[model samples]
Target: MVTKVVLNGVAIQAEEFEEEVIRQNGVPLHKIRFAFKVRSNEYHDIATLLYEKTFDVSVPEKDLNFRGTIQNYSTSVTNLYKENEVADYRLELVETN
Candidate 1:
């Protein structure tokens, strides 16, 4: 038996800042770095939220068959903020009979 979990369309939130430092020639240098953190709905939380949906494998007739075959499934998060607007995730199940 196999189970898979995926997270999609995660957003990155951060800010840009600059710092001044003295160089070898006594000249001031400016350095910049983008500081940010990843923000998104937690995968576990999303999975739990999906409980209300029809994601149950046992409910599907094809899932009950353990014959040699591969099953492909997918889910996605459509609405994301900033750079994480759209993403898709796929899962594959292989049965060894």
Candidate 2:
């Protein structure tokens, strides 16, 4: 379970997390992409903050902690009358130069 995405001193309560490494010619690269989400009521407050073109981002999880910048982001709302309480987000980031 994802806990939060911290950026620029603000923490966003996230519900999901995904991390991927980009490689070229079987060699490792310094760039990384991360996706995270926020469910329930806090979605509206923190949704916009995750999409900054360039900002310090920190993802502290049970297994690993990633810190980088906001390369990109997208959000999805369940919108179901019964399950209208969920917000999903996907984020991309690259290592700071």
lDDT of each: 0.32, 0.57
Best by lDDT: 2
Model 1: how far is 64 from its true place, Å?
3.0
RMSD of 1: 21.7
TM-scores for all candidates? 0.22, 0.51
Query: Which residue pairs in candidate 1 have backbone atoms (N, alpha carbon, C) closer than 3 angstroms, thus clashing?
Result: none
The 10 consecutive residues of candidate 2 with the worst lDDT sum are 78-87
